[model samples]
Target chain A: MPISLPPPSEEAEAENTLAAIGEFGLIDRVTAGRVQPATTLLGPGDDAAVVAASDGRVVACTDVLVAGVHFRLDWSAPDQIGRKAAAANLADIAAMGAVPTALLVGLACPADTPVETLAGLADGLWAEAGSVGAGVVGGDVASSPTLVLSVTALGSLDGREAVTRAGARPGDVVALAGRVGWAAAGWAVLARGFRSPVAVVAAHRVPEPPYAAGPQAAKAGATAMIDVSDGLLADLGHVSRASGARIDVRSGALEIPARLRDIGRALGVDPLHWLLTGGEDHALAATFPGSPPEGWTEIGVVTDGEPAVLVDGRPYAGGPAGWDHFVR
Target chain B: MPISLPPPSEEAEAENTLAAIGEFGLIDRVTAGRVQPATTLLGPGDDAAVVAASDGRVVACTDVLVAGVHFRLDWSAPDQIGRKAAAANLADIAAMGAVPTALLVGLACPADTPVETLAGLADGLWAEAGSVGAGVVGGDVASSPTLVLSVTALGSLDGREAVTRAGARPGDVVALAGRVGWAAAGWAVLARGFRSPVAVVAAHRVPEPPYAAGPQAAKAGATAMIDVSDGLLADLGHVSRASGARIDVRSGALEIPARLRDIGRALGVDPLHWLLTGGEDHALAATFPGSPPEGWTEIGVVTDGEPAVLVDGRPYAGGPAGWDHFVR
Candidate 1:
């Protein structure tokens, strides 16, 4: 947990914190030597970057991260925070069955913030953007008391129809891509002072979203899809409301990873709670006509009933508290 | 100066408080009846929106506005703040010679922030986006101690080459497509307690960018282009640095509006300060091969020399300090 790079010496360096280096200098440093894809007609030096959208359509989403609210300096590094911010926005783009192409970021932090921290944040953003073959094109930098990051992701449809939450049909198969409840389990372990594996902690810090599964589901004729940011049951409720179809989850079919089970046991909590009520997993949940595409696990089915989510044909007894921003 | 709308009460209205309405409800209220142009394939109500990029490229940029730092709640209303935020990002898109198609916003405010305030912000955003024939596609909301807004704008190239700052050549005509220093003059008048007019205050709160001028400049064979968020000299300095050429401005050729001159006289400050050092006007500055398009005024010329901007063949001696975010 020590500083990864040597601490800056006041004399060795130019005593240039972010305040001293200033916004323009930091922008130049971050954008230097970065290769923009051919889809980008203009890059970061301009007022805005022009990127190719050959598919004749674009997918867009935005997310904001505030220090002490979405993240903490004591727990997460700047790189992890940046990656998390990008991942959240990218996941939303993926949910719309689009390929991410570009990102725009807005950052606000105190003047005293270390220059290295800002560099690390940029590195993290680029790293995450690289996962989907996208680049950070343009952004604004400003001064604030605490760190705040806001990212907007742009994506292309590649001539595919967008998969929306309202497209699910009755009798469709419900499936999921990527792991679920890992982040919540990881959060529990971190909150309860349990020494889980590094991978679990990393999951909590930066959820690895299923980047390719969305377009793959679209290609395979997915009826509807959404990313699981708010717990599984709560997110399903969105699908049910939008699609006007009842969703019934077969809990017995869930494949709870062994590590999550071990952590749940260690904390004397039920693994099912993590699976049902845990959030920020960034997993892709979709409904298909019959069988799902490869790498998807069957979890439930859509049926004709009131627009509600049920667990094994009964109303879920657990409270509907998932992730409400203003509600306690 | 008092609160314009009635304060929210428990029995006032269903959508009066964000906490009462919830995130999804607020989203529905904001997005209801919004009409997307043909450029958008998929609009709001999904995790992300899909916009058309018919020319195979998109232009993107982002900006952040924090209360007390960027704007004062006591001075500017929520509607003005929203319009300003959208204008700042959209202006960047226009500066890239692209037509804006869509926008994404991230909002963070105190839980006690009235839903009416949020509605006003949305109304302002929609009004500004409507001016450019675009739509607000996706966004995220969270709670914070103060109001913070982040906007990302997307634009289409429409089969034209993107105009970049590096393309200027010696002898190119430096032309301007919008008014300069108006925002700065307005800010001075407001700061000095000289109530000039509502239009002056409106200019300070929300800029009127020349949205059509960028694409028109590109069509007319513009070599390089930029949005003058910073002062003319400083913004042109960016073009000079990128193109590795000297730029000479003829101050006598500048078209200072009579309104600005009146405000300058009222505030007892040099109008040149507003013209040289003032920022946030969001005007279009570009270099043309020959004559600029209609409505563009010639202001300067590109020269062969070290990268620098000069006024009247000499370094400007006025104390025209350009904007720097880190410095107050």
Candidate 2:
């Protein structure tokens, strides 16, 4: 809860919502002394922030998280939502084999939402971005009926070729880094009103993405790469179809982490289902022509055939399902 | 009304809302055949888009707009909303004295929102971005309770120093390019149910910012610049406060555009009031140490007396009248 709010000033603080202090004051509270990486030549309070480029190019990605759809206010705090939103955008940069440099946040919240909440969101944004040596460079705030966060991440390639989904080839080993199915398991635990094992609940709130492994995989000659944001099988399908190849996920090869297994045993659900179908984990799934670099676990292979993702040569049927905002 | 939806194909066209087609399906419909500008090395359908950076740095800005607050679906078409959203962000880039190169959009709409509406929105985005020689490089779509648009624009400094709000000094001439108070006038016309002068009504739906004059003024050695977003006095106050100088606007020297004057005459309101208080014009206001470049109209001068925006050597008395999202 220690978000390091600025020293109390004439501007009204947490007693009232953002409406009391107004937009400009809220912006000041959220952005005061927010740290920036070296890539940022300028930070907030400008028309635009100037960021250093790599290889004469910049990698940019954006994501929007709606309050009711992407997260529940009752279940998650402002810091958690902020971190998740930042992670989602950063994961895309990592998926592209790039290093994140800066983030521009666009936040829309109800007028009655607390200014402290906004400050906490900013704190979480800076915390998550700072962990990866990036900065929250610029931001915009507006009033809406509900909370809507749109985050744009800018990254640098560091003079390396970007790994795309279209590059997977036959005989390539498909590997993954970072934890899988933990966030999904966390969501399940939270949704069912079961709060035992606090880590599971926390995972659902904040996702820890493998940011560095992206550039490392590209360096290790990753043929195809994607951040597993929409289930392991679902996202791999994109790589498979784009590469015009078949990806086979060996079920035995996947090691379900202890927390996921604990939740599965308590709920009587298969942990593998969450591992394969639970999304929002944001782990790196890549296909390498040779050996994968350190911290990567080989879990599958790419083969020349129909563009399908098969688990142990069989197609995976989704479980109780994970988060999909649009589909009813 | 002619939104120019893509030709019907095997995919579900306007028959279904986003919920009916699912998220990936809706994405396919929305992104198909999206045009990319030449600066984009890669466009949508990837984890991230690679945009060409100029002078080893990229200028970035973001803005958030919510439905029913910033726009209304009943009053404006999807295309108009899309164009306005894109214009707002591009205007910020121009305020930085940079050339816009690419945009990343984040959209959150209700599940019941029609696919055709989304497509039309995409068309509007492309049309507006194309007019500026920029591309919609990438975007994220999600479901929310209401429509929310968060736009991030990336611009190129093009080897010129960014003309920030803090660069102005005493003895600089204050100049302006593009229209002022038009959008607010249009909003007033729309709110009052006046039907005459279709141009005013249309202006409320779409803002036309002078995108070219930003880089031109920078090339001509602009001291400070800002987009006239939150009224002339309010935004000018930002430049004045940041630059530690006073800006004096000579009302007799100002020429109220003919259309604004006609609207004011018909409505029996003082045109000067709207000229000073009305916002959302997105016109470029800059300070020039010497004579301003071509197409810029000199309207005021900077003074060393104080850090306040004065209308003919007196302070603006309009209290709590400008755009503040949180104040009801």
For the second chain, the TM-scores of the candidates in order are 0.93, 0.93
Candidate 1 lDDT over B1-328, as tens digits, reads 8769876666776446787777776788788988877777778777888877776777888888888877878778888888998998888888878889888898887776778888889999999999999988888888777678989898888888888888899999999987778788778767777656777777888899999999999999999999888788889999999999999999888866787778778778778778877777788999998989999999999999999999999998887557778744
lDDT by residue (tens digit), candidate 2, B15-131:
478887777787788778776778998888889999999588999999898999888887789999889999989999999999999989999888878888888888888888888
lDDT of 2 at B219: 94
Q: What are the clashing pairs of model 1?
A: A51-B57, A51-B58, A52-B56, A52-B57, A53-B56, A53-B57, A56-B52, A57-B51, A58-B51
Evaluate residue A68 in candidate 2 and report its C-alpha lDDT on the 0 to 100 scale. Answer: 76
iRMSD per model? 1.4, 1.1
- List ranges where model 2 is wrong by over 4 Å: A1-15, A318-323, B1-14, B318-321
Best candidate according to lDDT: 2
In Å, residue B41's CA in model 1 sits off its true spot by: 1.5
In model 1, what is the error at residue A196, expressed in angstroms?
Answer: 3.1
TM-score of 2: 0.95
Alpha carbon lDDT at A49, candidate 2: 88
